[model samples]
Target: MIDIRDFHVRYGNNHVVRGIDLAVAKGECVGIVGESGCGKSTLLRCLVGLEHGWQGHVAIDGKPVGQRRTHEELARVQMVFQDPFGSLHPRHRIGRALSEPARCMGLPHGRDRIATALEEVGLPAAFADRFPHELSGGQRQRVAIARALIVEPPVVLLDEPTSALDVSVQAEILNLLSDRRDERELTYVLVSHDLSVVAHMCDRVLVMQEGCFVDQLTPEDIGAGRASHPYARHLIAASFPDAA
Candidate 1:
């Protein structure tokens, strides 16, 4: 339940995201993959209202998402950024970070919300007392995910959700995301440079290059290493060099 038409973003003369059209259905997990400076994350920032200086259409579920979003609208959509450690404040404890969204949205049951969010993300309830530095890399990411879902948003924008974690921890986080999506019927737009990560989590993959989509691949195509675009093929080779 995201719709974009002719979306474009520019920083001075540099048009980072140019003339893009995309639609993601409800309860669908779609991934945008590309190299650095491809505008993949820039597009995501625009979706969640972080990048306000954008042109063209951007609507969520039916309502247009402009530079300013209402509190209710923001509560309906949330984002999980790439670096969990950096996203969370070093001074604030876990419980405060998780409950802040619910508080801002004026949602009740702050304690219950924090507790349930931690549980849903496979974290212990006592984690609320812990600080970010005290937790491992994976735990920090879990806290980030829990923070995103604490407000019970329908659409979640993920920016390289697993990139900061170790391989073993990355798989755990992926499974948790899949399970949470099933339980909540979430609509996710994930951005990552890793095709394998996208293949495992997304129903479809959009290959982006030079600020636009060059190709679209299904999970099957990604699994089979059948990339149509040269960029997509290169990505496959880079991610799995031995197999390629």
Candidate 2:
């Protein structure tokens, strides 16, 4: 459902993402793991049309993503950003926020849709009446997920979806995401620095370094501490000091 070739991103002289290629099948959850400044989030920005300065061929759900996306194209893929509080409007009620995408896409029955979206993410429809600041961190993130799913997008780009939440809340969000993916058969490109989160959620994990994908591993490989590249091994060692 997603494809990219020779993807490169630059901001003037600093080339953040260099010559990266990726393909994710429909209904597959792929994880990109790396340290800070590794260009993992940059790749996602390009796909979501936030970083149009990128040079690459990015296609989502069989449509090529260009500098500006059409309404349909915008609805084809939605993003759940790293910070849920900042992503939502501080003053707007959750219902209004959830209805924005459907509104933009001209989708009908927005009220009912918003309610359903809330339920899908384990939030009560009544929460829609509340504001972002009125809810807890996990509740805000759930609203973010509901907003992403409101339009019924085929692909969702998650940038450190659970990173900002408390450790206890992280598992709840992950489980909610897993259940939603299974129910909707959604394709996900999850960018995160957490190795354990990636291992628990992704089918295939790509180790990234210096703006490139250094190695690819299955969850089994991560569990067994099998890493071929030096950086990959280093990452594994840091994440699992006790692994054999």
How do the predictions measure up, each by TM-score? 0.97, 0.97
Model 1 stretches astray by more than 4 angstroms: 241-244
**lDDT, candidate 2, at 193:** 90
Tens digits of per-residue lDDT, candidate 2, 1-244, equal 9999898999899989999999999999999999999899988887877878888788887777787888888889889999999999999999999887788888853678888889988888899789999999999999999888888899999999999999999999999999989989999999999889999999999999989999999999888999899888888888988863
Error of 2 at 240 (Å): 0.8
On the 0 to 100 scale, the lDDT of residue 198 in model 1 is: 93
What ranges in model 2 sit over 4 Å off? none
Error of 1 at 26 (Å): 0.5
Task: Residues 98-203, candidate 1: write the lDDT tens digits.
Answer: 8888888888646777888899899988999999999999999999999889888899999999998999999999999999999999999999988889989999
Worst lDDT run of 10 residues, candidate 2, spans 104-113
Q: How much lDDT does candidate 1 score?
A: 0.90
The lDDT per prediction is 0.90, 0.91
